[model samples]
Target: MKTLSLFIAVCIASTCYSQLKKLPIKKTADLHAFFHYTGKGERIISGHRGSYLKGYPENAIETFAYVLKNTPAFFEIDPRLTKDSVIVLLHDATLDRTTTGKGKLSDYTWEEVKQLRLKDRDGNITPYRIPTLQEAIDWARGKTVLNLDKKDVPMQMIADLLRKNKADHFMMVTVHNAKQAKFYFNDNPERMMSAFVKTEDALKEYEAAGIPWKNMIAYIGSENKPANKVMFDLLHARGVMCMISAAPVYDKLATVQERAAAYRDIFAQGADILESDLPVEVAEAMKQKH
Candidate 1:
């Protein structure tokens, strides 16, 4: 009996370690360096909404872990405020779609929110509960990066959360424009951002704001186009990596083969990173190239 128990414990520990792919980032500079463009065809995969799988719920820590188990990828998560002012990982203002609970997320306090279980994309209820942003941050430290997308939460509050946890090394914020980027930059000079620079005018806006290019990775657009080549060249010249989000476009394709082809084409067209809802599939598609 004793030998069996010891064997089970060892297996559990090994399984946990194998599931996590560590980023090895300990400081802000390390995070920046990881995202810096090197012109060596470095392709990265980012999980959009934590890579919602059949059994895993979107924006749940469990889903994030499942993706990391299959591939080395970071996550783009949404943060929203509760009625009692606690920050939580949720993609929508309403909980009906992603949780067992109904009504607005802000209508419930953290205590009430924690009681509800998460639902997968197919509406199948899972045992996983909603995770606090702080809980997710704690889990991501040294394990993976969490890119917080702009939601209903105020920018100052998000910045304060980062300051409170001292999580500048692994946390990144999504900024829609130069002003938002500048705000985070001024708060912490080492802060890394995923900025929207899909156009030449937007590129000029960041240049005018005077934020260092080393501090950002530009999101060129949803689809790969002839125009993206121009932005890729321009941003790559500044040592900033370029990303393309396929969540809106190719992830909705009719078949797995079609999505896989789209994933391959994105990198073939000069995108440094591809953000997708099916990160595991994306990893599988690009396995040979990497």
Candidate 2:
């Protein structure tokens, strides 16, 4: 009986790992092709902070895996620098909120950071620890795409890390403006970017910067508004996918029905991608639309 139980456990674990959805992008060209808008109403989902599931701490590899097991999606994660200049996946500048540790994250070395356990959104401590940026890039190779949100880490450092890992295919950086986008573009013209093209002016800036539209997915904004239509028409014409983040807006809806309706509305309005804190929930909500 003991031998049978151990065999069952191993089989279950293998099945779970095998069930994960993967984005099999092999190079920068493939990544760009994946994000290109075809205007067939294809909707992509991205997990904000990896996901906001109970007991699965945000930005942890476990949380990312949990989402992939349920549905196909990418992740938008934060990268911050430690005292020793190591890059780690963490949203806040301080560790007090998401981890068992206190004080600013920059004060701790990676060794000290590794000793702390991660906490879920509800503040329940979990077995997962802080993951380094390198670990994330390595793990996401063929699993899914990772969009690295801008934090305290320098652009030079991020570029160096991506080069070291050869992760340009599966990794993307979020740039707030054309200047930041140009920095990455000049470094590697093939690098993919999640750019903030929330306004016509912002869109013009990227156009003026001369960064190829093939290398980007534009983030329109958090809400689905009438104004977004103009941006959508513009970007889609250029074969760029536009993303609407529901992390701040729709995910906060008081009930599941309301949130589901909002999620459906985002796609119906022609947004190609939806970034959310509740990616699993968004996936379920989107099912009813089809």
* TM agreement with the true structure for every prediction: 0.95, 0.95
lDDT of each: 0.92, 0.92
Candidate 2 contains a number of clashing pairs equal to: 0
Q: What's the lDDT for candidate 2?
A: 0.92
Instruction: Pick out the ten consecutive residues of candidate 1 with the lowest summed lDDT.
Output: 11-20
- After superposition, which runs of candidate 2 have C-alpha atoms over 4 Å from their true positions? 1-15
Model 2: colliding residue pairs: none
Q: How many clashes (backbone N, Cα, C below 3 Å) per candidate?
A: 0, 0
Candidate 1 stretches with Cα past 4 Å from truth are 2-15
lDDT of 2 at 24: 67
